[model samples]
Target: MTTRSSPGIAVGVVGAGSWGTTVAALTSANATTRLWARRPELADEVNEQRTNTRYLPDFTLPEQLSATSDLADIVRTSDVIVMAVPSHGYREVAREVAEHLRPWVPIVTLSKGLERDTQQRMSEVTIEEMPGHPVAVMTGPNLAKEIMAGQPAASVVAIDDPRIAGALQRLFSTPTLRVYTNPDVVGCEVAGVVKNVIAIASGMGLGMGFGDNTRATLITRGLAEMTRLGLALGGELGTFAGLAGMGDLIATCASTQSRNNTVGRRLGEGESIDAIVESMNMVAEGVKSCPSVIDLASAAGVEMPISEQVVAVCHDGRSAKQALVALMDRDAGSELG
Candidate 1:
């Protein structure tokens, strides 16, 4: 297996979505990064054209980066593996990676969703499949297109071991992209997943023509529920105030680039879930992660009113307008309660 290059470690990124493609290209500047695409044709385009046209249209990738369709090639030829697949594909890909993955190579998850049936976080799902491999999550307010456009951004690398987290922090860190380390993996994962759900609510408000005050209220109150659930899951309260929580929430809620937000906007504009989903190529994680977040909140005995409304709109066949009315009519309580 190929190990470290002169300056940085070799990285194998599985999944060639917009975020994955952007990350692999960015990492290629400092490391030998290979991105794996599910389709051979897509892989060939990335290899020959140095671009993933379907995912990151009109964006050019670095020459140092490569693409492949072989999972074994990635697992066997890299020092580190980055899991960038959506949550729906995480397990199947994890099982495949496990068969060929080396013992010491750490796997970092870039997914921001939970397993539907298990309701387990991305890091937990990785460890379950690859028991001996170190698992970590890399997350923040990173919009793939913005990063690809070379706009400066910061993110957190969360893992239990400070040493491993530090090593990864350096591997992903660039001059324009700063990577911070956090030992609270739970908080990071929870924040990453829950923010998408909240973004949907925020998007619905935007589609319904709500003012900035309404948007601000959803964001602030959504954060409260996120912190409460994260705390119940053994995450640090302070972690929720950092990039993975507040930063990510703001970006997803406010930015038009977010897929979850777009889905919510369309739903609020009177599009049915079936029609919207059928027309899209990319997965809107909040649509699937909504129920799982509700499940987690229920298990923790926390009241996530916004998340519950999101679930109602996405899954229970409730109209977006109806969900908003229900949320607004609920009994009021203390801000911190």
Candidate 2:
């Protein structure tokens, strides 16, 4: 890891999607920040227009930030690298960059959602691909559009090394962005992945025209399910109360801006998953995450009723009403139970 005594450091961002562009824009303290995009044309546009018109339409990128299609140049120049690609692409992209990355260069992941086949978190994929490299995750109630607009936001940086987390806190922190550090890497990963499933459930409630009573119940119960699954997977309970957990869940589940929520709303409005997915160019992570989350909960012997219902509705063609009925009819128990 390129350890620096000061806060300002060189950073590399891999991925040119909305989230990546937003982070690159927010972390402008870096003397030289390179954003790696797959399309050369997109990089050129960003460099010339001072805006990622396709991804982040409204905000202009800083002149100090450079966009590139070359991973070699980015990895060679960056002191800290961030992977913001989707979870499905995590392993492949990490392995591709691993060959060029300097040893011990701290890698921060901003991707949420679990691997469909491996059921692994983004950090797990990173470790498997780049052995002995330090890894951390950044997550919270961050909406890309809001952050791009310079809205005040608070986020958590979870890493195994306190020093690394502290360094990252200084690197990414801005006047509008408050950054906190934590050592519970597993807890952070679990919270980031599982909350998408809950967001899907919450979106279903909204689409069905459910009232505040129903939404409140879903949020509370969703937190319970998240905590149960997190604990079963060996995560700390307090982590669920922090940014990666409740903070992320609230932003995702309650907002129409969330891709997962948008997917669920479309599903509730009688659109087929195939049709909905085909209409949008961007990925809706919850649709892909549902089955894997269900599988993980099953294997862990943790009852995730909300997640299970979401999986059934999305994958099995179960009607939203029917799924809700089945959930309500489950054997009753105490609120805590």
Lowest-sum lDDT 10-residue window in model 1: 1-10
Q: Per-residue lDDT tens digits of candidate 2, residues 201-316?
A: 78788888886787788888889888988898888989999888999998998898898888877777777778988987677888888899888889999888988998988889
In the predicted model 2, the residue pairs found to clash are 1-104
Q: Which ten residues in a row have the lowest lDDT in candidate 2?
A: 1-10
Residue 292 displacement (Å), model 2: 1.1
Q: lDDT of each prediction vs. the true structure?
A: 0.91, 0.85
Going through the candidates in the order shown, the clash numbers are 0, 1
TM-score for all predictions? 0.97, 0.96
How far does residue 206 in candidate 1 sit from its true spot (Å)? 0.8
Give model 1's clash tally.
0
Regions more than 4 Å wrong, model 1: 1-8
